[model samples]
Target: MTAGAAISRRALLAAGAAVGIGGTLMPARTGLARVPAAFEPTQRLTLSAGETELRLLGPDRPATRIYAYDGDQFRLVRVPRGTRLEARFENGLSEASTVHFHGIRMPNEYDGVPTLTQPVVQPGGSFTYRIPFDDPGTFFFHPHCDETGQAGRGLVGVLLVEDPRDPAFDTEHVLCLKDWRLDDRGGFLPMSEPDGAAKAGTFGATRTVNGRVHLDLTAPAGGDVRLRILNVDSTRVMDIGVEGAEAWLIAIDGHALPPVPMDTLPDGIWRMGPAQRIDVQVRMPMEGGPVTIGDYRASDVFTFATIAAAGRVRRPRRGGPLALPPPKLPLPDLKAAEFHSFTLQQATDAAVKDTGLPPEDPLAKALIDSLCVGGATYWSIAQQSWPTGEARHLPPPLARMEAGKSYRIEIKNETRYPHPVHLHGHAFAVLGSSKGRLPKHFADTVLTQPGEAVEIAFVAAPGDWVFHCHILEHMETGMMGWFRVV
Candidate 1:
């Protein structure tokens, strides 16, 4: 038998044992019912987090010291859908770290939030994660502990779960959009400034696509090209658009949607914030030419990447991208869903408690400074600020619900800047927005504009799931909370 077929058989057997059926594992009443205690992993890999030098500014400039996974800036992890995979993470940095699988809906223990799901891996420590690839789509991973510092220095990687049933494309590319805060000498700058974090989180000075100043790729003329784009920036919002080609958006935040033409959207561009992703299919023109993908938010289009059509013309695929199979997720019963509301705004001094602890010694403070901790609190949710430093005692959950119950949450962004709110362990369906028409779709993160109220609903996933802003600086300070699901 072929190796691929052999692995497929093993995966089938594992799924059968997990669900007590000789077929694919299906969810029983709730999302967590099909989890297995132990199974042979279809794939296993090791990722080490450490500091490395990268010539991000230019080849002639000095290399900047950055943190990355497995010592690579553009590492991509691809696995087949419905398979069990194992990832062992080693922390080589001085501070603690944990890899959070950003948008996969799985068991709570593997969610990777420090102190909530699992303890942080200290320096030279290692942790293994057994993840079930039940849903297939575009996702990414990064350090959950001290994210502002680690991710800002380049600790990010893309994870793609390939679905065999999806239509094949002539060419495909993954683009990770990020920016770096650096000086002319290729030295690092402070990740978060107090004044900047207080309003809109601090932004990067240098922009890049996949850690390059300019990325050039090639494809055949008149072929369908799939572009999986992720905004891995800490605090930059992008209005992505395609130039010199006809493109359609087929997926958002790792979930497939009915393809929509780019021109039909607002101003022919899609607005994406931190931690958000979109899959677009572009049709290369019959004549050999360059197709540009850029951010159109500013007056001058900032072209970051380009794909050149070099080969002879091929017959173009008909129609938009084929719809991917729906994931095995419980549908929320809107009629019976419990309702809750939260306001995102600046925190008041009276609402925040000073963690009255003894000052750290110089030696200890230096270590903490290297990890970029001890930022001032500035934002809050529902008037409650997240406790930091000596106030490690977790506060009561913002809300609680029974497993298998449906809940609808209304998040109102009262602050001046936009907030990309992210919920862990569940993909909520965005119902609507008060300011603009939002396409109803399932996503783990949603960008809420200033003075906008966005509503989302989902069946509660059992765990202490964190709900917070995706902007790292804001989350680090005070704009974070959790929900309890029994």
Candidate 2:
């Protein structure tokens, strides 16, 4: 069957029986109603996006001109679970922009997808987003329009939803890992290169953590430290691991997992792609020592940050890392779920189909066109490239489903490079993979290996959700689609 084509009910049941994929067939529940109706804003804040100067190269070098939210390269917005947040975003740049709350399952209108959910916030204009912190985990927000140019220039921030039930650590730190494409004078290079976007994305020349060339901090000896690492880079994938400290992999993409020893994982490291997050608990040894965190995927191994065990011992090290509270999400009934499939591959002119779609506003189209990096379409999903510059209409959704219905989606990566497939407005369980075994966990983005097939199951949330590669270059070039849940 073709991608996005629905399987017959009888065939679906037969396949489920043959595979023994078991789950209780429960009545579909309206998941949208789970969001409280009388949520009042507990906190209000304003974020202004504009160009800022930062000495990215070094103190002796010229400051780089980059875009940032609230004049900071790494801004942290913490909202406690069960509370509501109202944030006003002011676009101070000369171009249009929108803020997408990555991994947050909120109302569709506030999703921040320009023209899809809300119009672009033009220059000097503002838009307010009312978000409910229902699920507590490590999430982020970034511009949905001109993603490659905007995000690569540093328009990204980390959003942490505090879960009161989560265990408190002696020291907690959040690291935002990103790369910069800068010249010797600290000026930005081209954000996207046609040849790079057509294949693997263009990698940045420099790497940093929390916008600093080197990050060093002190922690109490014999104490447990929680490190929340986020890969906010537009193109780079990192193999993150810690040295000189015993650490446990406690979470992935914000959601908690059974605490597993980092040493037990493959190669004692976890591969993190763009827009992915990982939470690790490190136990400092009694004696003073430096615990270094670095990206092992690099040729010489880049150490981005280090935590020294200095101050007096806070407490004796615990036996194991504490597990975080599981998020309350609707579980998918795989037995009765509808099946759909999508293939990620290279784009071709003949693959572009005219799906009946509504005409886009001329102004919005112009704004999007102006921000587009190039006129070439390089990647696609299910043989359909998302409409870009000069396209008169928006692309139709890859699939449409009834609200609250269970769905099992199989995404096959047919390209030469890995793609981190991200679905907005809902979190899905990684069922399994054809290449290897996967840990039991829930996430909004899954990094699929080239030529590998991965399956994910979730209960459809109400809204028009974007499904695309997390690699910003691939997404902008064409590897993007949407799903409509009515």
Candidate 3:
């Protein structure tokens, strides 16, 4: 799928079977491929990544040449929750690229990363990914190489895993919110400037929902509906809320969480960072009206979609928010777990003293500064930089342990900006936060607020697992590190 393209799996119309790409909304970096390509894939598709001229600004403005997936701005891939996905991806772009299924806990080998999990699918060549979906939730896919450019140009898609027992709704909508950086002629601009990549990621100039402006939706009056919203923008964080109806929060980051009162949040708006997903249930008014889903985070508040009741009035489906079956995840035993800590900081900041590295370290502290992209290194974990390119250094394990052993990692972010941190192979329980105790839930990616600390616990799995910030450029430049569980 291309950047502006969309995909949807609308309730299967009856059951668990997912339909094709049509609707919805929906982030990675490098490591080595652990396995070799050997067999023909069970499902094969060709994805071409290149320039596509888009009339985004206006008809009189010059068409902008942006990247896309399979000629679409975004590709939609839908299947049942447990389907074994064996798809071969042929890279047609001029540069190196690999597909990372953001938020899906698949086997390490199939988790696309150049040199880290799998080698980049070179231009004109191909790579096959085979994995079965073990959890049902809202997820997305994009490049792990040159992500700031590849994804910025367009290459992003929606991957939906449907659960048969999920609550039924009269209709469903997938809203992928993103921003684009364009010139006056609607032409391209430099993806990332040094200052931007080092600080809050480069923000786009134009906002879009599912590749278009002013995308309007329709639902029956008083009908139950599900909204799967994703923030695929490289930098902009969103505070989303409904304007015309009361909405119930269903899930967070694809994990099933009990419905919480909207009042639990500020102004009842959900704050979604990069790569975060929120599922909400909204019932249209008994009388016809437009339920506007708007993003109020920016200076200029705007409506992405208006769910208008154009159809005949229908009786409400259920009396309350739909309940979902909680995932049977491998939760860690906190009492017996070994504890470790890492502080997130910027490379230039002198406010905090460095600690993790010993004087005898093989990768010198100054060498870490050499790996900076765009001429400056910006971020770090544990006071160490995970440099890219020839300086690509996978330093010693943050914590080495035996497989299946329980461990708790305290992740602290002292920077003034927030980062959506992602773990490669295993799902961990969000144990607690410095702000206060948080409800425990399993996730592969969790957001860390600035000046806050979060602790996550998990059973150690055997592998070289990489953990890093999900802000593409942030990872590419410095905020990436890994662990080894043998």
Candidate 4:
């Protein structure tokens, strides 16, 4: 069997055996039926990734494999714009795992970050998710807990909710961009630094364009195409561009941006923090040319993919995606926002190594020490771990937003590593950011570097909301927290 296939089989078997072991090992962490009341929705469903010889609770299992977060291809099934989707999911992980659909404004209960919005679905148990598909466009679903390990293992999917007003395109595509840190055998290497958490969380070696190694798309001999790309990486900030083709910018992170012609290319790498999306239009060449998409940096080792335009095609007028109604709420005001300064600091290995804990337990000091590939510990929000109720203790922002109140947030990063910060339940405008206060480009998750800061303004939608770093690993260790609106 191919290496990819082998990886899938191993993951399926590992998960299958894990469920059985969970009961005898982490008895308390088994059977999601006992998930906290706050996390349990009114309904639940049974779900698994691959369809093979796998049992979420037994020894025999299917061949399901998880890829490092990279781009993925998805079909946008047309669904009524305001439809509510009720899905029950079985997190195919041994310990705990949950999924989050980024950029789709859903009910707080449906937001899938574990510990903050809910608990990780136990190995064999199930949980129901209720999300109102109020808005539509390119979005993603990924594990929110233990992001370092689970996400790296390929636990992400696509949720393409179509807008009723969205005009038809010759073709619609969903691409999830990600990379993997692997050895020759294709197994993932853990991200654990001995001294600094930032060092532990950085770019990997190999990059994948659509959850796989290479992408070769077949376009009509001559036609206009739409490519919706999302950067779901845990740490790599990419600069994307297209070669041998003509293109245009249609949208950004599910929000429609004024049409911009793609002439020079975006430094050849799509650079946005995790959960960010961009929609571009590429028209097939008249003479069938090779359209390449991805980076060409000196540091890049290979080209992600090439679109060979060699078949009969159609010619269509060039225009932006159908106009989307502005979000129901208005943008938040920065001036009136409750300004808060946050810092991303690293934890010392000495302090983390010998917590005076035992060795056998995975949660014990020595066991966790052994797992410390780099001795990195994802930071915490206000010093509180996730799925905790610490947000209640802190002072609320001054705006005292109602269910529909708009507010602004200023996020500053004190360390050098970049972070993809995501907010639940609302689509906010990136007002601008700087060390003190400067206007930067508008973006959802600003990949701020050390000592860099950015400001985001958004109207708060009602529901329990979460805001945290998108560095999957950092989030898994601790860098996560929540916000609630009653």
TM-scores for all predictions: 0.88, 0.89, 0.84, 0.72
lDDT of 4 by residue, 284-364 (tens): 677845888775444754566677765665454554433344434355666665444454554343322212213442222
lDDT of 1: 0.79
TM-score of 3: 0.84
lDDT of 4 at 465: 65
Better of 2 and 3 by lDDT: 2
Residue runs of model 4 more than 4 Å from their true location after superposition? 1-46, 49-78, 191-196, 200-202, 264-270, 296-298, 316-330, 333-402, 435-444
Tens digit per residue, CA lDDT, model 2, 135-212:
888999998877877888899989999998998888899999999989998977877777888887889988888878
* Prediction 3 global C-alpha lDDT: 0.70
* Candidate 2 vs candidate 3, TM-score winner: 2
Give the per-residue Cα lDDT of candidate 2 at 399.
Answer: 92
TM-score of 4: 0.72
lDDT of 1 by residue, 294-330 (tens): 9998897779989998784456676665566666667
Which candidate ranks first by lDDT, i.e. highest? 2
Predicted model with the maximum TM-score: 2
Provide the overall lDDT of each model, using Cα atoms, as 2-decimal numbers. 0.79, 0.80, 0.70, 0.53
Error of 2 at 342 (Å): 0.6
lDDT of 1 at 368: 21
